[model samples]
Target: MKVEDFDMFCTLLRQRSGLVLTSDKAYLLESRLMPVARKWTLKSLDELAVAVRSKRDEALLRDITEAMTTNESSFFRDQKPFDQFKQVVLPHLLANRAAKKQIRVWSAACSSGQEAYSLAMLLQEEGARLAGWRIEILGTDLSSEMVNKARAGLYTQFEVQRGLPITHLVKYFKQMGDKWQLNDDIRGKVQYREYNLLSDLTPLGQFDVIFCRNVLIYFDQPTKSKVLEAMAKLLPPDGILYLGGAETVLGITEKFKPMEGQRGLYTLAAK
Candidate 1:
């Protein structure tokens, strides 16, 4: 790829989706975008970049962004986060929010709905305690393809095998030829939306807990702070934020502090 073409794509990805496409990973970008290039009838990535830069086709730009955005996810990924949610966060919310009996969870950058559905499964396990309460789980991702797949609530055998237990799979999913589709009860508990984290989040309303795992590692520091602080606005003092095990709010923002003894758990800092 030409130097200018590489620079243009890097800038485009950062501006459009806050993805920092470093030069070292240019080959990865080229590989991922080759199919998109073919889809648009372009001969090579250079042609695709020139067309995107010169023509500014919004649809093509969106396709490029989606192609580059990583959608890696698995059910109940990182067992600790889910365990903390069940043992710590849920109890806190259950005890504190009795009067209103309402809770809302957001799975930001929710790739294929596994994280949100895992939470739904946990909620189902607490069926008796939460019977009369209203709980809502919303999963959002920038990629429309992923949002649609998440809505379908279907997973291949390989996908189900990862981070998912035999008991839960048997209880919650029905085998369809080669894939497993989650039961309507669990699937219905969560809703999926195609959304960008770079935009204003106020319209999404408040969330009592947010699971924004594994996505921020792609962002630059400023972009990380931008996204984290923006999320801070949507959470109450008692609300908890769950980031990927490698991600943190330290030196990023004062909006949240690490929850004691919880590796990825964060709570709003005191005013």
Candidate 2:
């Protein structure tokens, strides 16, 4: 691909999905987009790029963005965050908000539903303690395809093996031919939607906890700051924010402060 063409595609991705790609990522683009080209019956990625640059077909641009957004995810990925939520954060929220008996959590950029379902399983284990509480688990992703898959709540054997505990698996998932389907009750606990973190979050409402792990690293610094700021506005003063281990709010935003013992947990700073 030509340098100018690569730059144009990168810019288009940023405009559409808030993903920041550079010229060094040419190989990545080719590997991902080649399949898209084949799927659309185009001769080559160059042809797909030409279609994107024509600016005449809005649907083509949408297809390119969807092709580029990474959809990698697993159940209980990087276990520490969920453990902290169960041991520390959930207890604190239960105590502090006892009067309301409500807990709201948003799994921002949740891909394929594992993270949200993992949360549901953890809450389900709490049993009688959560009987009267209203738990809202909202999972959103920029890709509409991902949201649809999450809503379906079915996973292949290999997908189930990644970070999903055996005990919980047996208890919560039923065998559906060669695949596993999450129990309808646990699946129903979460509400999945298509959301773009780079755009308005107002329509999704607010939350007591937001899990936006491993997603901001794909964005530029300005986009990262914008996302964090938006998250801060959507959280309560004492709401918890969970980030990927490599991500942080230290240099980006001061609206959240890291919790002492929790590796990636941050509490929204009081105004």
Candidate 3:
């Protein structure tokens, strides 16, 4: 792509998805959009840029943005977050919300549902304790395709092997021909939606625990702060937020503070 065209493409992506792209990331953008270009029967990335500029098609723009959005996720991506959930966060939430007997967890930017499903499995393990309780696990991604796949609850052998324990796998999944399909009970526990994190989050309602992990690295400082502030509003005083190990609320926003002894865990800051 030409230098001018590359800049335009980057600007479009930022405007649509809040994804920041530097000059060094030009190759990464090209790699992710090549398939989109081919799908639209464009000859080159430059041509794709031209088409986007001339047409300004909403669907096309959405497709390109979704393609560039990273969807890398695993059953438990990192071990510590789940550990914190089971050991600390969930326990605290269960006791506090005992009066209502309801708990809600949001897996923001939940790529293909693994993170959400993993939480469902944990809830399943605690089913006896939560027998009369209402549990809701919501998984949202910017990509509609990913949301659909997540709702389907189907996984390849390779996907199932990633971070999924052998015992849990045997208990929760059924081998459907060559792939594994999560059982209906676990699959029914979570809901998937295609939503942009940069947009209004109020409609999703407040969540007791939110896992918005590994998604802020792509945004600029201003965008990062904006997102963190919005997240703060959705969280109650005691609500927990989990970010990627590389991401932090410090130096970005005052809405959240690190959990005293927990790594990659945060809670709303005191006013």
What are the Cα lDDT values of the candidates?
0.93, 0.90, 0.92
Candidates by lDDT, descending order = 1, 3, 2
**Taking the tens digit of each residue's C-alpha lDDT, what string does model 3 give over 106-128?**
99999999999999998899888
In model 1, the clashing pairs are: none
C-alpha RMSD by candidate, in order? 0.8, 1.1, 0.9
lDDT of 2 by residue, 1-271 (tens): 8787788889989988899997788999888888888877899877887877675477777778888999989999999888898899889999988999999999999989999999999999987888899999999998888999999999999999999999988999999999999999999899999889988887888899999999999999889999999988888888899999999888888788998878889988767
Per-prediction TM-score, please?
0.98, 0.97, 0.98
Error of 2 at 166 (Å): 1.1
The residue ranges of model 1 lying beyond 4 angstroms of the native Cα positions read: none
- Rank order (by TM-score, best first): 1, 3, 2
Tell me the lDDT of model 1 at 198. Answer: 99
TM-score of 1: 0.98
Model 2 alpha-carbon miss at residue 148, Å: 0.8
